[model samples]
Target chain A: EIVAAIETALGGGPLAGRRVLVTSGPTHEPIDPVRYIANRSSGAQGTAIAGALAGLGADVVFVTGPAEVPPPAGVQVVAVETAAQMAEAVRAALPVDAGVFAAAVADWRVASASDRKLKKTRDGIPALEFAENPDILKTVARMTEGRPGLVVGFAAETDDVVAHATAKRARKGCDWIVANDVSPATGIMGGSENAVVLITADGVEDWPRMSKAEVAQRLAARIASALGG
Target chain B: EIVAAIETALGGGPLAGRRVLVTSGPTHEPIDPVRYIANRSSGAQGTAIAGALAGLGADVVFVTGPAEVPPPAGVQVVAVETAAQMAEAVRAALPVDAGVFAAAVADWRVASASDRKLKKTRDGIPALEFAENPDILKTVARMTEGRPGLVVGFAAETDDVVAHATAKRARKGCDWIVANDVSPATGIMGGSENAVVLITADGVEDWPRMSKAEVAQRLAARIASALGG
Candidate 1:
């Protein structure tokens, strides 16, 4: 790791002159001033990937939500709370060599979010309306102008992991999709270990369960190669 | 602090031989396997209070939800995820001398929570149904048998702090209510300092803004006095 950092400092790695963008963590959609809807992602895998990319000499821009793990030391961190804010941040950090969308963003947000805390009344529970959040990965991948050279999306699926991820890659118009089973029994959502399936135009490759850092390093190397660095 | 620990070890403080129950943190109500609802409580105040009570030689059973701050040492910690589990834990630690309900428990949980992660489909947004959660403080305070000598509740209010908390005290039948303005402007919801108003049978006493640790120590001392320690 020290050697990698020294090499990056000397601008000597394969990705020396490349700039990359990574979005990580779970976006919190607020229902009220005090309460919010969140996901189980701890951002461990995303943070590790950002660190790995930076270690390989890529100037990384990490747009993150309120994650349990702190951001890596050498990346430009843009912290956000909601899907809208994350999308805005991603738009602002554009024209990179590659884009990695790893955040577990909420599909919908409470359309009727309240400024005041909702109280229980004799009338009964309040009705919560919902609205769709921005599809950040698809927006970036389908961009016609100034799009990243390679766009990689992530799919956290409970069932039909490969099929879901493969479909996601096509639907989002991304170059690659890193798929994982995040079922509670799998313990991959917040755990240190991950087992991922890489889905590309060519085919699928299932990687064995390993530490998040190892998965990140392997993925970063693949990205470096794909970017022709 | 070391003297306090030594005194507690020697059973020399005023609260020696007393058994206290303290509930802290924010309860997470799951909406699905990957998504859930949470609040902004960091649990700093509640953790400090538990530590202060233990410092005074009390035997403390700390019932906590998912909190940012860890449980204090010298107390038996019972960790829980949701309000229902927290209520069950509180019920199990019964017959104590006093009970401090400091947890920012969710009043409502998604009754329509799915076992599987909800996907975005052509069906538009999924409708969410809510149900009232167990009122832990009120349930314990209104207990007919095996009731603690004193029951204390907390209110995090955005407006009319004293009036709301005073009404809560009457409604819940708790002995006292520790009320605070948690409006975002005050920065008290997740910040270190607090300005609170204590509502009792006598009247409302507004405490000046102070560090959370100081507030905890003062409240612990008050509890000791109320219990005739």
Candidate 2:
């Protein structure tokens, strides 16, 4: 209560009355009871973004997978494991001022996940069947009602990041797309700093390589100003 | 330094003069510049085992993937990210008294990993082809020269835990197989407590549900006794 009073008295960074939703980490799509498909997302960027939003006094709902880093303080955290669970959590945290889909959600999941541990036999190795996962960003972006005022997505690309992200922005029907070059040579996939191109309706804006926290603060400020804070 | 001296003075449990190798966490196999396939192993049990062995005064080589927890102190930590790299590390840490194959190694990797990030095209979502990963435990257990005296494997099973693990012990040809039920109801996948059955040539030993640390200590003790420490 004292912290809330202080934030209110100091005018609370801007976006004070707004609520935001952010998704981070890689979803684990189960192949069986013990094994699942996952990615190398440490959830550094998404966690930073949630902290930045909360620092700005926004009501933040952070839907995260089994993140390597712990979730930030002062936010509503709903932990999930699989992509399907993450999508459901995102939908449940809807009707916000903005939604940032930064999670590295798996595009496919085992179609027939086994109830038992997969056995290696004399017959041969097990062959897994896969099915496509639901597109969470597109589903929320294409929402006819109860959609967030601003919808943002992330594109982790290796070649021609700007071009690919621009195309992705249109196809996903999201307001903005933050794209990055994740080539191994760049050492950025699980790194601390990031260089991104923010693709908005106005134009593409290139951001210098900076810490994830800086990126989050800049994005939060832009969102506040756009929301007439 | 004081802690090390104290352990050294106490003769460090039963496995004081022995050496052991342990693998932990999930391996990531790349599909593109930014995306990869992974698993949900947290490396908690493996980390505990490493700590326990070190407490027992064993020269421990901890080869781990991108584990959630930091490696235990007073041990050689060889960090890796993919199943192939982990296999290489395990081989390099050979000539030990015991080897614990606890990592949730991915069964497959993308056969033709793209040098560039996979773009979502108008044609459709991309199709990924997988190739089987090498059987690390089996290869070591079947080694002709400089093999560990005792090789322990872990099986995370959903159903028929003891039966499957017994079969696994014969198939892998390892000294012992520690099997656990990782069904969702058990809450053992990412949980702190574990219930495991130790399958050895003598028979199956059912262990009560306990903390990961206790499991590690008990397993380490068993390894020490088997290794004639």
Candidate 3:
């Protein structure tokens, strides 16, 4: 740890003097004071990515939700609960060299979320109205000014992984897309290993299944290369 | 730990030869393959209660959800995710001397839960249809043939704690109700210390704020006395 800090201080690594932003974990959308909607993201991969970036001497800002895994060392950590909170935190951590949007942000939130716990009534079960959450990746990617040089988005699809991710990359106008299949059979949602396909302007590169840390290391190296470090 | 085990084997302590059932944690109601509804229950109090009962030489059957706190040692642990699974698990561990329903089971589950991840579309956000979950506490409490001699329900209320808990006890036909205010200001929802009110046919007993372990020990002693252990 001390050696890494010293190296970072001396600007020794390829990503030295570069600033990067990462959003990790699963954003929780509240239904009431006590209840919320959540996903199966453990933040293992995202945490690993932030650690790898820091190891390469990048000053990292990590905005995360309620994750099972803790934030990595040597990064500015901004902890948030809801998707809206995460979006605000991301906006506050702007103008970085690269932005990695890895968090499993909810698509919609409870529009009629109650401040008080909803009681079971004779009428019937409560109907939960929905409201769309802000598209953080697209907002950052399409920014005309003060935008990160490289905006990498993640696509966790259950079917037609390549097609869905490719479409997502184009729709969001992101520089690259890290796509993965999160079907239960894959055992990758909360698992240590990840099998991902990287989609860029050139084409797709299917990466073999490996530990989340290894994936992070490789991705960090690619980011360094892309930024002409 | 060895001493406790030896004592339990020798049928020692006040609750020797007795069997007790406990349900702990917050039940998750799935919204989709990756998303679900959850609460802020850490299961600290419930785990401590189960441990205390086991320490009193009771054969403890602990049915728990995906809680932050792990189940106590020296108990049969039945892990579950949703309220339906928890209800089934509770039924399977029945015929005990006492039953404690401490889990914050969801009142409703998403009836329109999807097998596949719902994608964002131009149309709008998805509306969630809710269905009432089985009332586990009331079901067991009203069971005529094989109901536990001592049935205890829990009420996590934000307002009118005593009145709400008293009504809950009567409505569920349970012998006792453990009530606590879980308002965000209380800091008791996910905290170690708790201030609770115990409601019974005799009336309400307001307990001073204390560590969850202490509360559990006291409650277990009361259970032992009521069961004639």
Candidate 4:
């Protein structure tokens, strides 16, 4: 249903005509004009996924946060900072064949962010009211109309990733959940390699510890298969 | 007082015998193994400052957080993710002639960051308690013992840059405050160019719109002059 033409990378493959939306990086929730709340998501995996999707001949709309890496060439990029902006960007880029929600969207944002920079006090700390950020994947997954044919979400956990991700699949109402253990001991949070579990309606499948690029390629292949390409 | 023979870049000049410390980037205060709070600091200005300091023949100890840009070459880079770690790195790199606090340190960290990832709830959002982060600039500026001869702090403000910066200089007890407006209208925040107001004990000096590199060079020159280089 995406009438607007999206620029895709060179080389037509199995997914040549398909359009995909990919969210990458850590979403910053503004606390003030100069300060924000964010996470340690380097967006390496997300970036790799976007590239993989593009390589598979999909027109990739890369919606990213302030990621460490620059956007990969030959994709339509929409750069947003805060979670709300990211959600809005995601919605705007929707009505695609498939969607990947890989960004570590902050669960909460300051309910009332200060327009001015919050000043430091001698003794007292500022009381920040909190508001839950929109669940982008859930919103897209539950869409009654114009939803992407396949929707994916990610779960970064420290313990019991499968059990947690299994529950998350049901909770978020997403088609699949890519779960990974991000414990410091795993050296996966900011590291280059990742071991993930893919939970679907069928069951959970464990992926071996591999380079993020490999993971992306395998996941992209799976997407192609699921989409009957 | 830096007895350890630290490495210095080639071609000693105005800052040949001086040691300088610079802080940049945004600290990621962990909310969980995978979630954190951070600011929107690109670390461009701080990297430029460190490069400029090194260009002036100063032994630069660059303490940085999770930044978008990579650390500059020929500087002692101490990378950290949290505000506490940044403060510790700064302390360890101390006994310097000058210190530039450019890092956008998160004001608060989760009071008790959960060991495991908080799950997606079906009903309501999780409540996150926050605690004040260590005041890195204030701590370094107020140090009577082994205090850096010249301490400079940055104040990214949106309104009344000079007045707020002047007050911040007095309040934080720092020697000078480099204040800039970050209102979206200015296109300064996360942008390459900056227009700043340098507030000192003498008076406020307005710096023209220039690339962050130029600002760093000028500031480095001022530091060299103050150190009687």
Order of quality (TM-score): 1, 3, 2, 4
What is the Cα-based lDDT of residue B45 in candidate 3? 93
Q: Which lDDT tens digits does candidate 2 get at residues A69-126? A: 8999988999998899998898788789899899989887889998777776555567
What local lDDT score does residue A52 receive in model 2, on the 0 to 100 scale? 79
Per-candidate clashes come to: 0, 0, 0, 1
What's the true lDDT of residue A100 in model 2?
Answer: 89
Candidate 3 structure quality by residue, lDDT tens digits, B164-210: 88989999999999999998899998899999999999999999999
In model 3, residue pairs whose N, Cα or C atoms come closer than 3 Å (at least 3 residues apart or on different chains), thus clashing, are none
- Docking level for model 4: medium
> What's the best-to-worst order under DockQ?
1, 3, 4, 2
TM-score of 3: 0.96
- Stretches of candidate 2 exceeding 4 Å from the true structure: A1-12, A121-123, B1-7, B10-13, B121-125
Q: Score candidate 3 by DockQ.
A: 0.76
Candidate 2 CAPRI grade? medium
State the lDDT of candidate 2 residue by residue for B89-170, as single tens digits. Answer: 9988888889999998987878898887665555556777767889999999999888889999999888889988999899
Q: After superposition, how far is residue B58 of candidate 4 from its true place, in Å?
A: 2.0
Instruction: Chain A only: list TM-scores of all candidates.
Output: 0.97, 0.93, 0.96, 0.93
Clashing pairs in 4: A38-B38
**Candidate 1 lDDT score at position B139:** 99
Q: Score the docking of each candidate (DockQ).
A: 0.78, 0.56, 0.76, 0.59
Model 4, residue A156: displacement in angstroms? 1.8
Scored by TM-score, the top model is: 1
